[model samples]
Target: MSDRTQEMEEQVAYLHKTVEELSDVIAKQDMELRALTQRVDLLIRREADRQSEAPGAAIFGDERPPHY
Candidate 1:
């Protein structure tokens, strides 16, 4: 094979390896993100329930506002 063809083949191999590694990382990140999203949803529902149950409930375990 010509030098140019050999160089192109090497580049293609490297790119394929990189792509596979990136795919694995992305899949792991997607799973973690899904778990985090579910946790956030649960927290939101819990907070909403708390608010509905008691309107004057302390938002941050106390009556002071954020500005205080």
Candidate 2:
């Protein structure tokens, strides 16, 4: 094959490998994001439940200033 053709083929191969690697990274990140989202949702629900259980208990149990 001509040098130009060989160079093109190599570039294509490199690009294919890069794309596969990026795809794998993206898939892993997507899974991690989903897990994190679920965790956050669970935490939010728990916090809401706690707040509802105790009306006077602030979010972090910090009382408002007297001035309000």
Candidate 3:
């Protein structure tokens, strides 16, 4: 095979490897993002529940509004 043909093949192989590595990284990040989303949803629901349990509840234990 000619040297030019061999060089092109090597470049193609390198590009393929890079693409695979990037795909794996993207997959890992996607999983982490999903987990974080679920956690945020749970926290929001918990806070809503706490608020519903006590109307006008103070965030810092009886810390009323400045206007009050």
TM-scores vs. true structure, each candidate: 0.73, 0.82, 0.79
Q: Report, for every candidate in turn, its global Cα lDDT versus the true structure.
A: 0.89, 0.90, 0.89
For candidate 3, lDDT tens digit of each residue in 1-68? 99999999999999999999999999999999999999999998897778778867656534677788
Select the stronger candidate by TM-score from 1 and 2: 2
Best of the candidates, lDDT: 2
Candidate 1: give its CA RMSD in angstroms.
3.4
Candidate 3 clashes between residue pairs 3 or more apart in a chain or in different chains: none
Cα RMSD of all models vs. native, in order, equals 3.4, 3.7, 4.6
Q: What value of lDDT does candidate 2 attain over all alpha carbons?
A: 0.90
Show the lowest summed lDDT stretch of 10 residues, model 1: 57-66
Worst 10 residues of 2 by lDDT: 55-64
Error of 2 at 38 (Å): 0.2
Native-referenced Cα lDDT, model 1: 0.89
Which of 1 and 3 is ahead in TM-score?
Answer: 3
- 1-68 per-residue lDDT for model 1 (tens digits): 99999999999999999999999999999999999999999998898778768967656634577686
Q: On a 0 to 1 TM-score scale, where does candidate 3 land against the true structure?
A: 0.79
How many clashing pairs per prediction, in order?
0, 0, 0
Model 3 RMSD to the real structure? 4.6
